[model samples]
Target: MDALGIAVIVAVLVVATTIGLWHRRTDGMIRDEAADKKRRAAILAAAGVETVEFPDRKSSNAVASAAAKAASGAAAAAVHGNDTVRAANAAARSAAAGVPAAPDLPADSGIAVPVDSGVPAPAGPVDEAASAEPAGADPQLAEPGVPGVREPGDVAAERKSGVVPDSREEPGVVEAAARDASAAGESLDQGLLDRLGIGPAQATLLQFSSAFCAPCRAVRRISGEVAELLPGVQHVEVDAESHLAEVRELNIWRTPTLLILDAGGQVVKRATGVPSKPQLIAALGDVLPDA
Candidate 1:
């Protein structure tokens, strides 16, 4: 072959290698987008604001929101000084301003005050319930300094989970699938299951497979074995090429995509590519009674 043909072959080889590496890098990743969406909605509700659904996981708006929340929490935590530090600072300022620091009083010191103020004291026993909180107002906010109530800084921190400044690892499917069942939003209806030839099943392991894919065979076996092991769980496989409409509607981007559905057909978990036996079992933990 001529040098030109040789160069062409080398370029094709490099391109193929790059594509294969990219595909291998992203294989077998399961996403828990439903839980992420619920968390974001709660944050918006707490702030008394609403935003359009996030375009995608990596959209600029989503990234900005996460960064802003993280920064706000770190700032709050840094500034919320301890009680001892605050007290010491108050005493130092009082000394500088020539104001006397108030004496610390014991908690059990029974003292009586003369009704010297213009306002008269209560005649009967003061109603603790009445003074506990204002009508229709939040008790915590009304008396933020009260001992048992969390301060605003702590509350803000609690709302946001820890944020890693820079991390590229994907979340584990098992960990994500363990979330509340309500967060699993995607579901297949009974009519659709009947059409797919899947009979009554407590949990369905629906897999989308393609003919040319080798990994699909392994996934088929794994899913079938799992279904047999777990009662009330049935394995159903679909040909992606033939079911074009279903693939498009379900957003099945790749072959061997597994969907774990509950008794009511809600998709509790999803994983793409070949999965291990333990991973599949863990993904089905929330849906199965004894798992």
Candidate 2:
């Protein structure tokens, strides 16, 4: 072969090798990116959040509509269940009061007495000795289904049907249940604050943020501004990713979650989104000293 032909053949071979290497590198980069995304999704899932792809417009609208309908149906079912329970309780009370099952009284307001078929009234006037004796009374005539008296079976039935019977113990049960509900609904107590290493302040704002969350930045800014405006108000920001244990303990499921703590470090208010300045100020006022 000629010299020029040999040089051209070598150039061709080099170009082919370069192209193959570039293709392999591109494929590896694509694989690595996919693996990284999968890892991130897995981490989010472990933290009680599922990563979702952006849906098309139509699918998004349909999903929103379905969610709204589901919510409405759930609310309606709750209302219906409450109403049914109330009606059952009212019926049970009415039955216990002898309001509906009581027999009609005599029109003349006279005592009702049952006469024996074969017995007749004495025609002659009663003697002094016989008149002095008291007349015999029938047990049934003395009481006509005494009001507010319930049988054991009836009480059990009412209870099984979700009607709380009127008894001395009922008030205590209701009070205890209310106390439990109040306690459950309340925010972190002093002991929990101490365990979390949160110090005492007049008002404290805790912000939970994730690394890739844009709204978290806005929340941080707002909380900082509020803290600067109010004296003795401290703002604490926590990385939701790094502090997984604390996030789980606080039940923080989303980024930019704000918890407003009172003087005793008890949570007074909480918000999930970027709250307005006025709203935050008002919430701080409620927990701040001398507000």
Candidate 3:
């Protein structure tokens, strides 16, 4: 072959090789993202935060974190932090308004679990060490407090005319304060929370499903009935297909998983497969109490 022709062929080969590598990298990225989401879901579920609507928390926290960093002068325009932050804020607003898609997870370098054709429970019982009942005592204040629950009537009389409970002012103290606040603004989110069916007060019957969960209507009905059987409990349904976040948040790899929490928002029980009403009721009453 002529020298120029040989050179041209070599250049074409190099370009093709580069394109192939890029395609492979892109595919790997996609796979990794999916795996991370699954892992994240499992992690969240394990933490007993199943009903908090992760996408909202994630978006809200991202915005708050960004604002804090910017306020501290840690963001860089050259790094496009401003643009990214702006985009996240806009996305957050859209997500709140149901006007946009949920944000995607950043691609990761770790592998996720095996192919889940069926909703499989974890291999064994809750890891004894992690699930240990804090030496016969439940952890103190692990569950989030339920509003309109045991509220002191004087809480309303002490309210200001227009002041909202600022998570600032006291700053970084709201989580604990928000959990224990007896003030007016601090206790009103219960209706919103009750609608979501999550609180430490009792089992809200988030869901009762099974593996290969497709048509989740039946599962919802069954779960609802069981939840009703228990007073002060709210039942909510999340189909495995539609709300993977809830599954991941509550480590619900198995359908028919039950998440039992105390009023402090801590996960005290995780039951996979169908559990009887008595079994579930007993779990609701179970806690470490002082751990």
Top candidate when judged by lDDT against the true structure: 1
| Clashes by residue pair, model 1 | none
Error of 3 at 198 (Å): 4.2
Order of models, best TM-score first: 1, 2, 3
Q: How close is candidate 3 to the true structure, as a TM-score?
A: 0.32
Which scores better on lDDT, 1 or 3?
Answer: 1
Number of the top TM-score candidate: 1
Please, what is the TM-score per model?
0.46, 0.36, 0.32
- Relative to the unseen true structure, what is the C-alpha lDDT of residue 186 in candidate 3, on a scale of 0 to 100? 10
Error of 3 at 42 (Å): 18
lDDT of 1 at 224: 93
Q: Give a tens-digit lDDT track for model 2, residues 41-97.
A: 568979999655332122222222222222222222222222222222332343354
Using lDDT as the yardstick, the better of models 2 and 3 is: 2
- lDDT (tens digit, per residue) of candidate 3 on 152-240: 33223213211222323333312222222111111113333444456544334556464575434454554567667766666655455
**Model 1: how far residue 114 lies from native, Å:** 46
Residue-by-residue lDDT tens digits, candidate 1, 171-232: 22211222122223444544566666676566788899998999999999999999888887
